[model samples]
Target: MSLLINIQYMPYVLAAIVVILITFRLWKWKRSLNYWRDRNVSGPTPVLYFGNTLTALFKPFVYTEMEWYKKYGRIYGVYGLVRPALTVAEPALVKQILVKEFHKFRNRMPETD
Candidate 1:
C-alpha cells in the first residue's frame, strides 16, 4: 500500500516546524538563567539583550573584568549576549590554562601552537 498527502498542507507543515524550532530555542534560553546561581558564582545583573557586551566594548576588557572581580571576588560570571561566560581572577589557574594545558583548547590558534 502507498500513501499520499495534499500539496496544500505543505505550508502548514513548514510553519509548524518553524514554530517548534523557535520554541525549543526559547526554552533553552530560559533554562540557562539559573546557571550561575546554581554554581554559587556572583556577578553583575545582566541587561535585557546586550548583557555585558556593551560594557566590555566601551571600556577596556580588563577594566570590566576588574570591576566584576572586585564585586564578585576571585571568580565571577558574565553574559555575552545571553550566553553565560565565566571569568577567573586567579593567576595560577590562568597560567595553567594558557601554558600548562594549552593543547586542550578545542580551537587553538594556529599561530600559537
Candidate 2:
C-alpha cells in the first residue's frame, strides 16, 4: 500500500522538479541579458539561448561586426551563447590593455602540460 502511494505521487513530484528547473533557467537567462546593461554598456540585443550568434549566421561575420561597430561605437558588448564579450575598438584602449596593462592581462590563457 505504501509503495503504491509513492508510485501514484511520483508524477507530481517529477512535474514540480521540472517546473523548478525551468524557472531557474529563465532567471539565469534574464540575469545574463542584463549583464552589460548593468555596467552601462550598449550593444545589439540578444535572443534567448542563441545570443547574437544568429546575426553571424545570416550575415558575414566581418560585415556584422562592422555594422555593430558603427552602431554601438568603439566599445560595445556582445553575447556569445549567453556569455558577455566586450569589444574594444578604440586604439588607445587596445594599446592600454596590450601594453600598459600587459602584466594584468598576461594570465588570460591557462597553462597545460
Residue-wise lDDT of candidate 2 within 37-91, one digit each (tens)? 8999999999888889999999898999999999999999999889888888999
How many collisions between residues are there in candidate 1? 0
Write down the RMSD of all candidates, one decimal each: 4.8, 3.7
Candidate lDDT values, in order: 0.76, 0.90
Superposed model 1: Cα runs more than 4 Å off: 1-5, 47-51, 81-83, 91-113
- Give the per-residue lDDT digits (tens) of candidate 1, residues 1-113: 12346566778999999999999887776667557877888888776456678897788988888888888898788887777877777999878878988787555434422
Query: Which ten residues in a row are the worst by lDDT in model 1?
Result: 104-113
**Best candidate, lDDT-wise?**
2
